[model samples]
Target: MWHDKSVAFRLVRKKDVQETGELEAQARVDRRTKNLTKRLQPGNIAVINHSDIDRVSAEALVECKPRAVLNAAKSTSGRYPNLGPGILETAGIPLIDDLGPEIMDIREGDILHIEDARVYRGDELIAEGTVQTEETIAASQEAARAGMSVQLKAFATNTMEYVEREQDLIFDGVGVPDVKTNFEGRHVLVVVRGYRYKEDLAALRPYIREYKPIMIGVDGGADAILEEGFQLDMIVGDMDSVSDKALTSGAEIIVHAYRDGRAPGRKRVQDLGVEHVVFPVTGTSEDVAMLLADDKGAQLIVAVGTHNTLIEFLDKGRSGMASTFLTRLAIGGKLIDAKGVSQLYRSRISNWQIFFLVVAGCVAIVAALAATATGHALFGLISTWFGDIVHWFATLF
Candidate 1:
């Protein structure tokens, strides 16, 4: 049956996005959902995660750039981000948020139409009006808020698991030899999230002319190292907000734990089938990474994007980064902050030195040219061409 609807167009269902918040907010989504979103290409239809018209503006809605957004979320019409009609009004893409099970009834390739929040086939109206104008936005917001809380709770739950594992590690300890190894043997670039990690890396590049260090990314710092085209040697974090690509990267994984002694990343490691080590303690992943390397006998530790002040720790949403402070104390002698080193070791070539180098180069070139046969001929040719000009100038004088 078909209904008297206007916004009907024919297109194939491209990708099935069960959730939209993950991609938009850069938050964690289920593995299957994550895979689906990554696989979603351009010109594909997307299902809306939530229908909150008021929370998001119409301009923000257009940014999703979908052919048409199917709102699976409940929200009020007055809400800014969820107002489908206003969003589609200028963008020209159809808005279909509140159609009930009728949405499932439509085949993936079947042509459909929408008019005044109603769906139709050809001439028959399939379904009319599903989303409420005022309540949908509030409902969607509540759902999102609830979902975020659950995620946070999950993180907390894993923290407890990390603590138990730390106890075992403390009692058991690593067996065999504890012989330390020199870090100079390996490329060990300490990765930090600094105010100027990019600038520091550029300045320190000269030192890399001789020996490059193995890049170690701490948590989200993995993204920073990847941008530099270097393979991450190791990643230390609690598995929150980091991309899956970073986790599955060839880098060795180390999970940082809370002082309650928990290693929360073990499950993710097992799920991804990656080899990992658990270093449970009260510190950020960056701190644990340094400890692991230093204890293993690294000759030098280079840090980038590291928080060096009490205020820096606070900004990172940490109650206390004391563990980081202490760990640095234990290895400060060999530890070098990449940013600090860059500032101190930057090449200070003076203008006079540059001038001398240029002059020396010119003199060497002239000395060599003066003895060459071709040079003599070239000079003779130049002299003859200039002699006429000089004679003319003398006559004029």
Candidate 2:
């Protein structure tokens, strides 16, 4: 009794979905997008991979609007709390994950039936499958938890190596200056590389005069500062991504380093004849930027596009997210993530508009779908309707 009511649609790969899922989870963990916490909207079904359902974008499924989420990930075997199908259940979204890589092979316009999990390509049946069960979802949670532990361990090792190098550098007396900062009454803005910095900076132009924070750019952030037509008071980082103009922008330079005494990015500063000081430690350039501001007694540190999550570090091919995690901890009170500030302080889409758009879109989709009648009949109907409407308007005029 299979009905031919198939809906034509695009098939996104399970892998890509999983990657986004993990990114979402990491975003939540680092509190990068905390204002959007646990406010799941109804009737929006998100498709995700089981591997990414736990520590990363799991919060998305929990917070966003999703009626029933489709898990396009690996089978549940090991288990964890938030990683498996149980997470979906906890959030009241049905968990149907680990259908397999075979799902990736499905083509656009293929029909996927919910009751039996059978996929049909056009007029031909390709594969028959079943939805994941509760036990399998539990095992997936365990696997996710275990995997996170391994990733954290790898980060610890990387941090240790960085620390060892820092020790050696200190022995040679080639580290950051003990000079105190005198922002006593001046507004200080310590810029970092984090999300939507370009757009945020563009919107902040008018307010720049009001706050008047002395701009301190961290590495690539100097480029952003220059792009905003603002002078950089100081440029901090390894000096890898700062531009020639930023180097000569009359800003002080700071080179971040480890205990090994090697400042890899220092050569770039020297080549440009830029004055700089070495801030040697076991941390990322972002961390060094924050410390430089705090130690120098800056009024506030305003960060942007800085890697603040486990997934963000993984995206950069690092074993651990130690630097970012620790950096936030050290700069707790004075630090402010620009993303949160932007969302809260900046313009946002209104709830009424979102609802109106959703309703309008659904109506348009249904109307468009109802118009088709073997192509020929539909064209004739449209022509006749157009003529009648024009004739009626002409008569009225």
Leading candidate by TM-score = 2
Which whole-number lDDT from 0 to 100 does residue 153 have in model 2? Answer: 74
Which parts of model 1 are misplaced by more than 4 Å? 1-187, 259-262, 340-376, 379-397
- Which candidate comes out best when scored by lDDT? 2
User: Model 1 over residues 1-397: C-alpha lDDT tens digits?
Assistant: 2122224343212223121111110111111221223333334444434434321223334554544545443433322222334434446444456655445454444444444455555567766544232233345544454454454454455545544544333223332123223444454667765456666766766666566776778776786677766667778788764567888878777776665556677787889898777665655777667766765657778888787654354334353355456557666677887755556755589889999999999999978878999889988989998998999999998
Question: What CA root-mean-square deviation does each model show from the true structure?
Answer: 13.7, 16.7
Locate the minimum summed-lDDT window of 10 residues in model 2.
20-29
Error of 2 at 168 (Å): 14
* Candidate 1 TM-score, C-alpha based: 0.45
Q: Cα lDDT of model 2 overall? A: 0.57
Please list the C-alpha lDDT of all candidates, in the order they appear. 0.55, 0.57
